[model samples]
Target: MARFGSARFTTVQPGVKINNQPRPAPRTRAGGSLVAFAASAVVLLLLLIFILQNGQRTDVHFFGAQGQLPMGVALLLAAVFGVLLVTIQATMRRIIQLRLLTGRRRTPYTSTITRPDPADADPGADVPEGRKS
Candidate 1:
């Protein structure tokens, strides 16, 4: 066995070499940190391009109110509102489910004693030892 920088090189046969290194462990799942960062950067760059391309001012109407704003700003506001609505709805659902679960957990306690059925009792076995059935 040859040691090199916390790695062990073992020769199973005369010529075959196997490297046992702990630095580069096998990945259990796809899309590591670098891949995630690259994907986020791409998305941000696309969004920036979209905003720059749609910089023209436009009139936006909402509930009897009107305002002049950039097209990209209007779209971004709408997207933010949509996300907020969904988050609120999800939070309300989670709260309702939690309340229902808590309510159901408050069950009344039951007695441990149970009455035996008269039909299952053996009448001959209850008689005195000297007496005949």
Candidate 2:
């Protein structure tokens, strides 16, 4: 068997060569980055407003007593969380696409299909003679 790596497959039967090019992939535009940017900006804006109103005295805790962190640190953490969320969504979408490409046979819908059955026919059929029942 000959391997064509990334190239499209072509079949040769007898003296005739047939070019069976693979169908084009579907196009998509992910808004993960845009969402991440928007979320981070909103969080930062809110944090700025909070700092202006509350005078930047935030108590950041981890495992009970990890000491208080500055408001800047807390705002940075919120931005990181937004980025992680976007990354997770993008990763899930890629996994789903890979699964769709590698798994299950696709059966397309058809309006009508021809059936081959002689015994399964109308009993009282109207037709010109010469033709056998």
Candidate 3:
């Protein structure tokens, strides 16, 4: 990890270029954030292009409702609604499980572990096998 001509780390090793500072550490969080940001930007750009390209309005009808929406927007709304439905269903399932768990009677905790007998403290002592030995 030595860098050329840095006098600070000359004593660290023999006749090679010495680097005073420690080796650079990878910035995982920053790099991850940057990658995520780039991905998000790309996705946003693509979405914008898709919306612009599908600007033509189309009639939309849903359970006693009617409206006009751009194709891209309508599709996006449908996808969002689908995700919401799944999320709500999962939430309800978890709630039901929690309620069931709460309603059930739980056995009171009992310690099966008892203190070691003072007689059994010395391993070298000759003794009969005790129940919990």
Candidate 4:
């Protein structure tokens, strides 16, 4: 066999589309995550700007605790505490639900899976050692 001086390479064909129609690109988890991250970053930037703009200091009093904090910071803290309370409540509810589920699983009446007693199992029914039916 002799080699040709000019080499021709075959082009890779693109994938065939369904019904020969053009379809939009599919959404990807990374793409969605990137968008969410960008949105969160923008929100954080806006919050930062808001906090900076409201630079006035205010007195904060809570259950015998007194402190001075920026007005924006105080409001942000209040919102954070409120969110924490809801999170705690939801967490407690989930914990209680899990506990109840576990308790129910342990209860004899609630359990559906049953096993035969080992003592009730017969070694032989048709014949026995040194004996025949």
Per-candidate Cα lDDT values, in order, are: 0.84, 0.73, 0.84, 0.87
Question: Ten consecutive residues with minimal summed lDDT in candidate 1?
Answer: 13-22
lDDT of 1 at 82: 100
In the range 9-123, model 1's lDDT, one tens digit per residue, is: 5565443334842344456446487788899999989988988899999999999999999998889889889999999999999999999999999887786888889899887
Using lDDT as the measure, the top candidate is: 4
Clashes of 3: 0
Candidate 2: tens digits of C-alpha lDDT, residues 1-133:
6676957678854543347654454444556677788999998798777756655658877568666656776766767889999999999999999889866666666668889586888654656566846
Please write out the lDDT profile of model 3 over residues 1-133, one tens digit for every residue. 6668866554444333338665564579889999999999999899889888998999999998999999999988998899999999999999999988977867667768789899769774556657335
TM-score result, candidate 4: 0.65
lDDT of 4: 0.87
User: Number of clashing residue pairs in every model?
Assistant: 0, 0, 0, 0
Better of 1 and 2 by lDDT: 1
Kindly report which residue pairs in candidate 4 clash with one another.
none
Comparison by TM-score, 1 against 2, better one: 1
TM-score of each: 0.54, 0.32, 0.52, 0.65
lDDT (C-alpha) at residue 115 in model 1: 89
Could you give candidate 4's per-residue lDDT for residues 1-133 as a string of tens digits? 4467757666876656778875556899999999999999999999899899888999999999999999889988998999999999999999999999999888466658889787887757546676853
After superposition, the stretches of candidate 4 with alpha carbons farther than 4 Å from their true spots are: 1-21, 109-133
